[model samples]
Target chain A: MQGDFYQLLKEQGYVLGMSGQAGVGQALTTATTILAFKYRDGVLVAGDRRATAGNMVMYDRTDKVLEIDRHSVMAIAGVPATAYEMVRILEHSFKYYRRTQLQELSFEGKLRALSKLLKENVPAALAGTGAVVPIFAGYDAEQESAKIYFYDILGAEFEGVEYAVSGSGSPTIRGILHYVNTWGEQPLSAMSEEQAAVQALRLLTSAAEFDSATGGVNREAGLYPVVKLITPNGVTAMADPHLRSLFESNVSKGS
Target chain B: MYEEPYRWVEAVGNRRQYLDAQFAQGSPVVGVSCDQGILLMTMSKGTPKLYEIYDRLALGGMGHPADLEKLRFTLLEMAHVEGFNRSASDVTGSRLIKYGIAPVVKQAFEEVFKAPFIAKLLLGELGQKAGKDGFLTINYDGVFEEKNRYAVLAASSSVEQRMVEYLRPQSCVSLKDAVDLAIHAWAIGDRAQRHTDDTGGDPKDGKGSSDQPVADSQTLMTHIRQCMQGKSIECVLLDRHVAGTSKYRTLGSGELETLLPKDLSSALT
Candidate 1:
């Protein structure tokens, strides 16, 4: 039989939803402000480090952009507890399929797998307790190019042709991306790796400026947003030192 | 119907003999730990005998491909699920063999009404540091043993013992040396199997003559040349130095050429 880790877990009575019925007054920990866009070499994915429960900041160093495999990543932007569980399942499912089937899961198959998980989580999502809106980015080896996909809490998947954004600060970042990609000097897809990273830092800074849930770069704590690049080579996370230097010289100076 | 207990035991013994005969001509797989990581190598006509089981684990087997594939999937599902529910470090080779695979295999073997799995598996786990690597070998009867540093899976216990003896004292520090030693170990097991076939006798009987003589380098080279005529070498490495969660990598032919000695690399063509 084809190895399905998620199914195995389900058979073992492990549920991915909240333990008890979610009450309306319950404040769930949520994370946000994740974005992915096409760049010169491939796709650039970025997520801020802020996780908040209601109006209070729960954590500031959460890694929102998680690498699922060598070529793929899932940038989560909703309930942290639920999104993390989904990411773990995705990571294991991809690997399980590859090992058992002796081939990598097709890009379409991967997209469906995520959609299936979201569909299964419908009960929890509808209760307003555990919703996960995520942006999936990866280099499609078969297509010889990078691709970006975004999903709603109900599992409706859409291809982000140029860019995609999600979370509480999504409206602000989306508007800026559309404006820059349309009338800016160059399109987002034409930007170099360094340029793409700088743009991501500036965008997250702008989101934090306007959104309370969005935590921007904490210069005092030396914590920067998680930035990753998906190229034909593989997914590579931009280090904090590099992000710090880029924010100081390019993004901060320009603003 | 084997209504009597003695009859059931006789039938089980017959099954063992049948399973042994089935694996007589199967290729041997050699696994050794080196500074680079754990290396698994085998010679096959077409179907792959080596596979990546998890991030830090690999499997090499000698048996019917269908049976091996079934066992491989079983291990894969268990490992992935355990890793997801628990953590990566919790998914160890010993746990998979002891808890997951051994029970299923034992039940299948003892059922008497069902056919037993005609496969011998060698599992290698790359540890977090040097000298911590582990290798486990499982038999068709569900018997398994865990060893440190090296292990081998062959057609019969005698051949496996001979290969293990040859590798017991050897230590390799480089990938090239590990590959060379693994090929030699594979040659030893393959030669013993061929010897048993030539005599038209049981492998257990053929072990008597092979026990005293460890083949020299020249003999191993000749045997490797003779047996590798219509086969290709399949090698996989669980490299510790690789920068990723998954360390398993299949060495391609282009890379294998550099690792093999000049004479052996030229002979394959």
Candidate 2:
């Protein structure tokens, strides 16, 4: 069963029309904007809930943030189907390593594993039908600290010193994060998990304001960006009500 | 280059019997349900037999090392696959054992693969509802029985006898009592005398250790220290009360020391 399932999935394929050699003519309508940062308690991972198909919003409650394991999470920013299959494959691979080895993989090991997965999908990525860019964040038990890793389509792993953001709206979010870090009295790492989560939501809201692909917190439908806190305690998604209040509070403050 | 013909041929032997014989030499695993949650204790001679199947689910195996590894691997893959296929709230220890491992082991027994895994399993998981934690004892041959209080695997007859004798008919037990009873069961192999040293409670009384349990956590910790002299014991607790992320964790020596009756810092010395 090792890599057998992945091989089977490879045979099935993600893009309905594309084959091994053909490239997707147009970009896939996809979710955008995933931001992660290390704070005092742990790493905060966030993503907007909107999935856009071209100019039209395909889904408003799409979840781009996925829990990879108990301690780690990944945010997908391309080809929803490919992203899901990749997550499943990675999740199975991580658990397989833990089972056979009887120990969890190191943070570096996890990054390498993700890299391998992305590298294997290089052909599909080149075909443009199966591209997935992800931001990974987790609490490293051995190092006793929160860590964040970003990956390109080619699966090049890059460790972010303070924060990492991905997808089309990343530029906007990154700009805001830079502004916050430079203007704030303390480094981003000094902020609490709650503060970091709030900052992430605010940044995503701003991204949604400027970028059509990103979705803002919708008070009417009660949908909010998915926010997860990966603390020493464990990885948990912030409750909708909490995110709602944060949105309301932030909105109450004038621009 | 010459390739060995029939390389996949399994050596002719009683594989099931051989697997069981290996378990005879494997470590003892004891699981007990207490007020705090479920406590799973096992001796580690280097290689670990305990595994976290999920955030709340865990499995402890005692059998052929290869078979144990296979079982652990298959079980975890099934769990994660099942979890990914359904909602997270749908996955549970009992469900994994009942619907997941049970089928795999059943197939293994049917010789779906090379040979059946010779691994007895003790599974513990935090309950979906608060205070509903579960513990299950599974035979290597796919037979399983749900134990409310406690269960033991690959142990001396006396240890099994003591567990059945001490925990039967009890509705609930405290974490301290569970730890003491599990260790006491494991320690029974060394202590040949049948006398109840802690509080003189009759060994056969079937009163359930929690009925008039003599040892407090501290006293039991000391007793455990005395029993485990010159030995390192691996302990895990699936605490239901643990809020946030994961409810299962291995107890560190430092934390275990804090639970001891006295500073047994030099007890082994």
What does each candidate score in C-alpha RMSD? 1.9, 7.8
lDDT per residue as tens, model 1, A1-255? 356778888888989876347658877899589999999999999999999998899999999999999999999988888898999999989988888878999888888889999988888898888899999999888999899999999999999999999999999999999999999999999999999999999999999999999998888999999999999999999999999999999878554
Each candidate's interface RMSD (Å, one decimal) is 1.0, 3.9
Tell me the DockQ of each model, to 2 decimals: 0.84, 0.31
**Model 2: colliding residue pairs:** none
- Model 2 TM-score is 0.73
* Top candidate, metric TM-score: 1
Candidate 2's residue-wise lDDT over B116-229, tens digit each? 877789888766664577788777667777865677775323335555664565454666666556665554422321233243433233222234333344654555566555
Clashes of each: 0, 0
Off by over 4 Å in 2: A1-29, A38-43, A141-145, A179-198, A229-255, B1-27, B44-47, B63-67, B77-119, B130-146, B154-159, B189-226, B242-247, B257-269
lDDT for model 1, please: 0.90
A130, model 2: CA deviation in Å?
A: 3.0
Error of 2 at A57 (Å): 1.9
Candidate 1 docks with a DockQ of: 0.84
For model 1, the superposed segments whose C-alpha errors exceed 4 Å read A19-22, A253-255, B1-5, B208-212
Q: Cα deviation in Å at residue B170, candidate 1?
A: 2.0
TM-score of each: 0.96, 0.73
